[model samples]
Target: MKKIMIFGAASAIAQETAKLFARDGENLFLVDMNIGRLEAVRDDILSRFKTKIEIYEMNALDFDKHQELFDKAIQTLGGLDAVLIAHGTLPDQIKTQEAQEMIIREFNINCVSVISLASIAANYFEKKKEGCIAVISSVAGDRGRQSNYIYGAAKGGVTTFLQGLRNRMTHSGVSVVTIKPGMVDTPMTAHLPKSPLFAKPGVVGKGIYKAMLSGKAVAYLPGYWRLIMFIIKMIPEWIFKKMKL
Candidate 1:
């Protein structure tokens, strides 16, 4: 059984993934900004499985306090076998274009904070010389689009950062898994129209857990996003600029 730490425990995907771990008898250290919602998730998981559960209230953007949080979780769990960073904010591209402050705030939330948290996890895993650091990026990070370029740009930064970290930890026995998920039905994405392409949170979460176990460096879920983004990335810049995504 794994000793797992999830930074965004309250997120639908993270919650589902935690459940998967619980069912398998793994221990979990869950962190989220919403204490009430976090408590609900903790209770629900404990109700169904006989496993160790710990919850903490935290704002993901609070980078200054991240080291303390990671240390505490590691100490409580005895040792951590894996970590999942799932907290992120979707930025409005239109508002980002209208305000420089919006761009800064969005970047801070989606990129800066992620870098800070990943650093803490990476260093710990590197020293241990065995562990998995899985981060939930997005397929949008594969390329920029007219609609959500701001959010995509932030995710792109995370993808690139993971790439470099993966390179650095190549011989350290630590696996860095970058999970790029396509559209998923969640409260955060409630405004978007529903479709067959939009996957369920539980489905995506299970895919992520499986990818980590397989030690895959990069995974595109529900899988076909790989082909879709391949075509998008292959288009000529001139022709691409002329058409909408």
Candidate 2:
């Protein structure tokens, strides 16, 4: 059984993905900000799958604590075969724009911390010469739209970082998968109206699981997001700017 560590294990998408891993008989080290929710997910998963699971409480913004958490996860899991970094925040564009601190806080949580954890994991995986590092980006990262440019920028940074990391890790046999999911229905988006474009967490979670296992460099969840983003990216800047996204 593979030992996998999932950051943000309490999230709907991460919980669903963890279940898939458990179903495959993989042991998991789950870390999240809320110990209660983490434990809930652990208990729920254990109720169905006979696999070992460990949980740790950590605020993703705790930059200095990142290495400590990774160390702990490695020790608890007995050696991690893979890691999934799924922690991120969906920020309010207008609020963030109005408050500089909010913008920085959101950016740090969504981009800086992710890169920090990924860097730590990359070092360990590079030495082992075999491991998978999968992170959840968003289709929003593909381009900047007025609707949510702040969130878009942060995810874009993550996507770009993964691209560079994947390039460097390829020689070391480390697999880096960037998951860009479209609108996923979760607590994070509860205030937003639902549409056909909105996908259930389970669907996105399964896509993440498959991408990690297959070591895909980049994956667009529900797959069609690829075409959707491609078409958006192709739009001419002047005309695109005229149309509100």
RMSD for each model, in Å, please?
0.9, 0.6
Model 1 clash pairs are none
lDDT for model 1 comes to 0.91
Assess every candidate by TM-score: 0.98, 0.99
Model 2, residue pairs in steric clash: none
Q: Write the per-residue lDDT of candidate 2 for residues 83-117, one digit (tens) a residue.
A: 99998889989888899999999999999999999
| lDDT, candidate 2, at 211 | 95
Error of 1 at 131 (Å): 0.3
Name the runs in model 1 displaced over 4 angstroms: none
Poorest stretch of ten by lDDT in candidate 1: 88-97
What is model 2's C-alpha RMSD?
A: 0.6
